[model samples]
Target: MYLNSTSPTPESCEAVYPDLASAIRCVREQWCELHGYTEPFCRNGVWWVFPPNGVIPVCIRDVMNSDKGQWVRIGRVSVAILPDGSFAIAPKSTSDRTD
Candidate 1:
């Protein structure tokens, strides 16, 4: 799903899945395998916070506006995850001077 750029609370955003099974499978298979980390999977839209010793909950959102649109937003920033599971956030462009 595409992310809203003006989303208020990106960090606390909850991904709405079509069904419980899909969501659980995603947490068990995709999320864990991709991050090399595991946390308790939630079946009902419950929020989970892993301790410092555990893997941090990383929220990834699909980027749809870029020419090379294969990217995800990580903590209010855009990042490209590589095939090996490593990722790097795109640096803030100088043209973004609206502050």
Candidate 2:
């Protein structure tokens, strides 16, 4: 899942895959297939492609169109696309702080 943001970071943000880690892993293996590194990652059981765009599974536009300032959680990790065009993800077990 993704979310819209207005915080001064990338124009959008990233997230998700329902047990798609292997798929992501496949993408990661082929980073060169895209313009640059895919920046694939897994937090808790949730997989994500950060700075997403035409290269990855999702893009900034996806976040830009989502509910702003909302957090999208997958398992123990969560993705929160801010209201200032910035986005972040953190473990649900940790502090809510995004420093």
Candidate 3:
């Protein structure tokens, strides 16, 4: 899946996966590893928030992290992977603690 983000460059980047299920698995695992977040059975046509500053797809955490596209955090933030093999995010509060 790809999410447009302004990082090293303002360009649309993608996290390559064998398939959608693989992509979801990476994201869900990141959620749990980051803070032990439990993911529900992902439903179709739903936006799954990866969260602001949260690593997405999580397949490239070591290489890159938190690559949210387009959407920015106003105060609080969240990211969601749409059913279209794409990603979306919204401004919402998360339990993520700042250090």
Quick one: best TM-score, which candidate?
Answer: 3
lDDT tens per residue, model 1, 1-99: 222254323343345445434443443344444435445444345433343356665323221123222244443554443222333245567897678
Best by lDDT: 3
The residue-by-residue lDDT of candidate 2 on 25-75, one tens digit each, is 432334323434355455554444555355545342343333344443345
Write down the lDDT that model 3 would get: 0.40
TM-score, per-candidate, Cα-based: 0.24, 0.21, 0.31
Better of 2 and 3 by TM-score: 3
Clashes of each: 0, 9, 6
Give the runs in model 1 whose Cα sits over 4 Å from its true position: 1-24, 47-99
Residue 69's C-alpha lDDT in candidate 2?
Answer: 44
Q: Which residue window of length 10 is worst by lDDT in model 1? A: 61-70
Q: In candidate 1, which residue pairs clash?
A: none
What does candidate 1 score on TM? 0.24
